[model samples]
Target chain A: MASIEITNARKSYGAVDVLHGIDLDIQDGEFIVLVGPSGCGKSTLLRMIAGLEEITSGDIAIGGNVVNDLDPKDRDIAMVFQSYALYPHMTVAQNMGYALTLRKTAREKVSAAIDNVAGILGLNALLQRRPKALSGGQRQRVAMGRAIVRQPQAFLFDEPLSNLDARLREQMRTEIRKLHRRLGATSVYVTHDQIEAMTMADRIVAMYDGIVQQVGTPLEIYDRPANIFVASFIGSPAMNFLSGTCQITAQGCALILDDGTSIPFLAPPNVSNGQKLTLGARPEHIDIVGNGSAPSVPATVDLIEPMGLSTLVHVTLAGKPVKIFTLARPDLAIDSTIEIAFNMDKTHIFDSETELRLPRANEPFAAETA
Target chain B: MSTPGKSRLRKTAYWGTHYLMIAAFVAFALFPLYWLLKVSVTPNDILYTEGVRMWPSRTTWDNYTFVLTQSHFPHYFMNSVIVSGFTALFTCIIAAVTGYAFSRFRFNGKIVIVALMLITQMFPLVMLIAPIFRILAPLGLTDSLTGLIIVYTAFNVPFATFLMQSFFDGIPKDLEEAAMIDGNTRFEAFRRIILPLTLPGIAATLGFVFTAAWSELLFALMLVSSESASTFPVGLLSFVSKFGVDFGQMMAAGVLALIPACAFFLLIQRYLVQGLTAGAVKG
Candidate 1:
């Protein structure tokens, strides 16, 4: 395994730039995922690293060797495409052994390598079948197995699981994670699915508008998002943002909502009074409150979504929709009035102009530095 | 349930009309060919006696034996085969490369080049024959099989290229990229991976071009005057003289010429039937 470094890399098609100057230093054997919505250039960045695309500017070094002008085969990278891109005419064994065959490896060694990967992927019985005859999950396994059989310097996966059904995607996600554990090869995976990034990545690189929005461990990105984009893009059901103004009231720094409701937030000492700010909160942190214990706000339940393990209450607050997730299912009907409390300790405050998350002076929580 | 009888009558009427239409068209198409075969087998003595008859009163193999041994039909058959074979092979190779380029590449002037090729097809072949004969006469190209082959190849390539291009366009580009990353150069990928998948297209182009060249009479008649280089379509004219026409020998030669075209189709029908690129992509 080798460490890969992309320093100030940029990509453009003629004049329309798809990737801005991106600098990422991947550690040896690190599984980094580039996650973003479609057209955000995550796949473009991965293709640049794989040598499938030309770098418009800057340097990419793999194993301490610069490879900007090298072809994909010379770069020693393996990629599993979203379509699985298996040779339809070839049997599964031939598909897995293709790279070795190109390198003129010994016949027995090629067979042995294929058998090893197929055994690991549980593809022993389907070895002789062509790609058209295989199921979606099986074709995906063959695509992955093709990458593993060669043991390339690094693996590049371009949304390899996007074509699978949800249940199979979940199953294959664990299999990929476990395979990474066994191989310990440097891998760069690209996907638009944040759940896949959260579940499978050692470090998730969130991208938007061809720019790297944030790069950190999944927990770090989830807990200490750098900006409003990161905060909203990282979580399931997304974080809710309420436009408000900051006021240093008698009860520390408080955010006054548009509907004249105040929620307390622990702001740093640098924040001035009457500063415009936005309050951000995850739905799971907002709890349904009984009267008279904490600050209570009235909301109407617009809809309820039961996810078997937890129930999501969709409520309208301040003329905007807000979803609140809770384990306790309340006997509430649509359009019924309810009271909920925001968790003061876990709320996020952002400057309205900059949209940068303002770090709080907490005791142990790691605050993001701009 | 009482309407079952009426539904059965309606169904029979619908199918009966379909069969009647199909039968009429088949008879219209096959009657001329039937007359050719009938005349070839009828004994020469009974030609006038069985005049305008659908079937011969007496059948004989004398015409087949006489044409095979006494006439120059064998030599004409060989010349036709050589011309058609060479034309098909040359046209297919050039068309495959040009078609693949047109399908995949985004080079400058690509649209202009395609438009120019399509423009070539719009000109009538007869109008170009005079200029072609003038061009070929000075270079000693007229009255040569090579000249015929070249003309046939030139005329067939544009349509064949378009035919092959659509098939190549249907194949996904991802397959070749996968091959390139598997350690093969782009040309190697085209050869080993893509070329195999395009066999159906190649076979179809070959068959189309071959039959076209095999039956082309205008260019062959204008370009080749030597008896050695005359193609079968021109050779079929020799059976016509100022005296009475030799119907039996001409029909026998016509039947003999169908063999090669039939054999060519038979050879390529496997790839043509399989639609070799079927499972190459998701669609």
Candidate 2:
């Protein structure tokens, strides 16, 4: 319903700084996900926006008004905690209507609001039951219903689905996405799970070490991560990195691995010969070419995992581990040498010292600006 | 081939010894109460003859009637009830608030305050009884039930606060944060959400303080000198004469003193059972 903006927000416990100055501008009715590993300050930022935590420095504005000094109730935001935090003493109906009752709304109006939210959440039959009588997934629905009944300026969810089992989590994930679309409310979801960010967000804000690593659409992040941290953290069967030196020969440009295996590719324009760099290749973008193929790096197969829909082949390339994902199951012996080729079009090259993705020679500066 | 039969015998022996040990401990704990009950019913004429007998060969209700109608014990019982009831009420209120602050906040000097409370509990009560009585004398509270209530509440608060703090710690802090985000202020959230969830803890503290004040003898003896303000423990001393101790009347009054404490526990027994916080969180 409203946009939330954060400018140079930083947090610290005495001298130990947790969040170094962060700046973000969220659009109205956008579903933004803050994703990272634990202790990355995503939850801290969300709490600061919700007015639960003080911003050690900087300001946060909700709906164009700065709420840095406001209390949580004054901020007009609702949060679904990871623990569900349903009031054990109150029944489902009372839990959902608590915010309205706190505002001293008319009884009929409060009930109507609760009824509408309950209908949307399918909680009619269980309205009379207390939190102890409901299952985990039901409690989660009640938590969501409580947030929706208030219809606050925005919604903040801090790992809301992490408490449920995998099957229920999967079901609720799609349900939450559908609910968000229907309501079209501005929501900021925080989770350490990358898949949740990828599938649920209009935009994903990837963070690491208390800094914003990248902010972009899911595919943009997957296709061209801004740096090595975002590159490795976003994908499943994570992108592999190989240390090599850039080389330019008569036939074409090639990367010479630390183990002396020559991997030929179309070098990006900015790289000079003998420049040290890290090559990143996603599993799905590596092919198991024929043994004597040209422009191929010979690898020794270490392990193969046969997933139902796709198989993952683990191989050692230039003394470094790399995983290859494919639809075809390869009947290859362990320790057997095989030649593999990188799809040069899908590959990423980063300056080793900076660990930043380098623009390819063909498209010069397209990926970096995104 | 015979493993099932052997294991069955093994389990039976293990359980049989476990039950035997527990039964022995239970009997050891209840023997004093059983003896008190038996002596209260024994007729005075046969009290000496029936010494050490499990069953008093003959029993009578004379001691019970005599203690109830003929002695000042009933007044003492009333005084004990008033003192204990007020002590429990005051201690619980103070403990609940202080415990909540200890559990939920990081304030200045919190560690030092907690350590001071612990330090108060370290000293022997006898050492402070003289100073307490001296302080109360000038205030004209030394020989009154109100004085007893104040002292008892002060003595019971530190322990009760610790007990309540443990209960509050078991509850998730998220519930109150969620309540605040739901539009209630922090104080309202404490009253409407956290306090209701702590009902079991409050009940436990009340029962604990009630029993402690009800049975306390040292302070009751040291503070009150008047028969009108005397509690049951001091009134029971009246039955002893210089010539000989009135065993029948004393035992009868002792038996009478236990009824309120027992009934008080019975009233709050359900809340004493843990698990009130279940389903408040993910569990």
Candidate 3:
């Protein structure tokens, strides 16, 4: 178990840049997840750290030693690929013992290591079967078993659960978290699924367009996204954004929508009056209020999705679509009008020009510093 | 109940047409080989009298006995085996390495080199025969089995390399990357991990190049004139003379030549079938 540090790392292919000046200091035994959409350089960064890819510029150090020019074998790292790249011709035991066999370890020692890992992964009966004979989830377990048998400095997982079905993905995700806790090894996981990042990471690093958007706990990123991109990316139903202008009314600060509806804020944002702004509100933070409410905006219900645990109500507010999630199964009909109120304290205000979150006057100016 | 009966009738009709088409194709392909066997067995006295009959009234083993006991066909068979065997071996080794590189690496001049290889296959072999003979004569290579093996290997490598490359491409690149991270070098990963999975591919390449070199006539006739260096294809021409063409002896030798190629295919039929199906699915 060791800390991995990346400093000013940039990756480019000729004129096309993929990762632009990334710097991350991961602590020992930390489970950091690099989360983003596809083509966001998260997988590329993980490959670079594993030495499968060469760093275009800057340095990466593993356990206080520079590993930029070292081969992947010298770096002492293990990776589980999205395809579960087990040796198809080799049986499960052979695949799990391959690293030790390559090191010329004693035969008994290698078998012992494989036995221990197989036991942990419940793969004892599968030891004699080839990879093609195993199910998808079993192959995944064999891939992970192959990694842990070596006990490398760190484990790099590139969307290891993406190939499994949903039920199996959920099961493997919990198993991976438990394995990380038991082993206490520094692990870097990459995935485009934000929910996986939210559920599995010790610290989530949200990225977009080859840039690190935010790095913090899952709840922190969900509560205080650094910009419009992060805010829209981190949530499940996604945060709703409405383009409007700030108005300093007698009731304090209110946003005047393009359709001429006023949505009052609990406190004024650090923006000039009449300046353009974007208001962000999560689905769970909005409530379906009755008509004639003071701080509510009238909306026409468009769709209703009942999820058994919760109901999602899609409505058009001031001519812009917004989703509201509630535990109550509201008996609402489509095309019916309702008034929805935003939880003002939980809502976010962004400068439309810079697309960055603006700190509220009452709150400390520490939200967007990440 | 009626649906089941109707589906059963449809199933029988479907399979009937399927087997009929396959049986027709088999009969069409095997008719010539049957004729060869029939002519090889016919006695010399009745061959002309038989007048294109499918089977003779009386068959004799005299041609087979005479070819085996009195002719140089056995020596020619041995020479052909050595040349084809060595050609298949050398071609597969070179093709595997070149194919792996073509499948995996993106080095300088990759496209240009691949295009040059492709262009080599476009030319007729006749255009190069004179130059090849001239080049080999000075090097003491002409009139020797070694020269034939070299030429056959060179000609077969490009196609074999493409075949091997497609097989290599069907394998996931992540397997080798994982092996490298698991403490083996790249070459070690290729040798231990990838090579085992490509056995079917290697078998297919060997079988293809073997049958090709075994039956090649143009180069064998043009290159080797010595009786000791002659392959069976060139040796078969010995049955011809100004006096008359010995059809019985020639057909006997032809039947003898088919044995080795048939046995070779039978030995590798498992891997060949597997490799073809795997390649088809991947493609």
- Candidate 1 deviant stretches above 4 angstroms: A244-264, A268-276, A291-293, A363-370, B1-35, B44-54, B278-283
Sorted on lDDT, highest at the top, how do the candidates line up?
2, 3, 1
DockQ (C-alpha based) per candidate is: 0.51, 0.83, 0.49
RMSD of each: 2.9, 1.9, 2.2
Stretches of candidate 3 exceeding 4 Å from the true structure: A267-269, A362-370, B1-3, B275-283
TM-score of every model?
0.92, 0.96, 0.96
- Measured over the true interface residues after superposition, the C-alpha RMSD of each candidate is 1.7, 0.8, 4.9
Better of 2 and 3 by lDDT: 2
Error of 2 at A145 (Å): 1.0
lDDT of 1 by residue, A1-370 (tens): 8999999999998889999899888999999999888899998898889887899999999999999999888988898988888887799999999999999999999999998888999999999998888888899999999999999999999899888889999999999999999999999999988999999999989898888888889998888887898899889989988888888977787888888877777786578888899888999888887766567688889999998889999998878788899898777889988888888778788888998887777635553332
Per-residue alpha-carbon lDDT of candidate 3 for residues A1-370, written as tens digits (9 for 90 to 100): 8999999999998899999998888999999999999999999999999999999999999999999999999999999999888887778899899999989999999999999999999999999987877888898999999999999999999999888889999999999999999999999999999899999999999988888888888888888888999999988899999989889877688899988998987654457788999999999999998777768888999999999999999999988999999999999989999989999999999889999888666765454233
Superposed by TM-score, candidate 3 places the C-alpha of residue B119 at a distance from the truth, in angstroms, of 0.8
Q: Which pairs clash inside model 3?
A: none
What tens digits encode model 3's per-residue C-alpha lDDT throughout B1-283? 5798899999999999999999999999999899889999999999998687879999999999989999999999999999999999999999999999999998999899889889999999999999999999999999999999999999999999999999899888888899999998899999987898788899999999999999999999999989999999999999998999999999999999999999999998887766322211111
| Whole-structure CA lDDT of model 3 | 0.91
Complex DockQ, candidate 3:
0.49
